[model samples]
Target: MAYHADIIVDENGKTKCGLCKVFIKDSDIYIEDHLKDTEHSDMYLQRLMIQNNIVINGKKISCLLCNQVSDVAEVLHHIDSSSHKGKMSSVKKIIEKDGGLLVLPEDITTVGSKVNCLVCDGWVEFNQEAVKTHIESAKHRRARAIVVQPLNAIFSVEGSSEDLWCKICQVYFENYIEVIFEHVDEDPIHLKNIGKLNLLIKDQNIDIEKYLHDPKEDKALCKRCGIEVPCNIDNLDRHIRGKQHLKNKK
Candidate 1:
């Protein structure tokens, strides 16, 4: 596993190196001293590769939990570890499969802009070129089909709004809000009509700020633009569809 290195300041104002997990008095030469430490340098490079999602030579995959690169055989063992599976299950509920696409629920705690592939459960590079390469991959296409087939089945089932089955929860919602917000965020098929959720929120006299402030309410952050959207799914989709988030990815 890759080591975590964060520069921390102690109560006495000493700088603590994350990887070394030790304190040194803050001084003009602190940075220089740390860089010269062999242990620090090795840990720093491993952390850098983790941050950039780079696999070292001969590595086949990176673990989703710790960002540790591993070979094909070792990767399987790492993924099966208790710690790894626990982390994977936490976000698995928020991942949905669409046609050749895996949609993730918006995460408020993410440090910076990122795009993650739910199928491989890995982070894809943020640039256009890297995103393009991932979308064209055969593995991604197969996983997407596994999710799309079932979603499309229930999507068109004829029933009363209350009787409609939620693909995520696999049960009927008591109201439209439950359908729009609760299940939609976890189901890719429901995301296609997110505008309906917005309008319902407005009609119910809810505010975007209220939603953001309250964890219980649906978030207003757009999955594509990372901005607030209008009250209708059609309008929201129109705004995001042409943008980089929904770009000719299919």
Candidate 2:
């Protein structure tokens, strides 16, 4: 076979196709047979498109899977990179399961320049780079695992309900949405467990008078240390074991 730039004939007489990452028998007949395979033909067309810069600007090529941009000279390396291959595999799985990729996943929403992640209750830039960065972030992954995944499984198993559950606190609340919101908002233990609450509560929806009259009362005052700590099991344990509190005890 006439060796192209992408096809290499090693010293061992093995013919390798860089794009397909396959080794064909050293004979010209075997090489030609492999190149005629439908899969290899598709890959060859892709290589041509990349070489001609039909996917993006002439200087750079944008990956169809992950939207990563690379110089024309480095396009092959980018395509073979772990990140790009992983994204391609993931998208292929989604397409196989869903029958198509026309619809965005439920957790993601794009609005102009902003992309909202329902799982994390946060917005990122709409570009693929920013969206990918946000999806791979620790906070977003944690939220998806702890909140979205569990909720989805529960809903699928038991059917949807208005009841609220806090996985961090391991507590389930009745359908009183406002009460659940207040429970999560005022409970220092819940706040500590979640680090920060991502739920958005409007000022008008909050009962200001109720909070004013019924302020948080479960607080432990350490007279020796002159500090007040939340009256939760974890907070009390931390406070008693703290160096300042130990020094004050002496």
List TM-scores for all candidates, in order: 0.29, 0.25
Q: Write the per-residue lDDT of candidate 2 for residues 1-250, one digit (tens) a residue.
A: 2236657877777789866778877787887777778887666655444332235568887665465678877766775678866765664353333222122322112232243566666655434455566655677545544443232111111354656555446566664434543554466876565442222112112112221122234454555677666644566567667898778767
Point out where model 1 deviates above 4 Å.
1-6, 57-250
Error of 2 at 157 (Å): 15
Q: Could you give me the TM-score of model 2 versus the true structure?
A: 0.25
- Tens digits of per-residue lDDT for model 1 on 1-250? 3322356777777788756678766774875677577888665655543433334466476654455667755644665578666654543433322233543323223333355776777766533445556765777655653444343223323555444444323455453433433454465545554345545444332345534233233334553345555534455446545555455233
Best by lDDT: 2
Where in model 2 is the C-alpha error above 4 Å? 1-39, 42-54, 63-73, 81-162, 165-171, 174-250
Which pairs, if any, clash in model 2? none
Score candidate 1 by lDDT.
Answer: 0.49
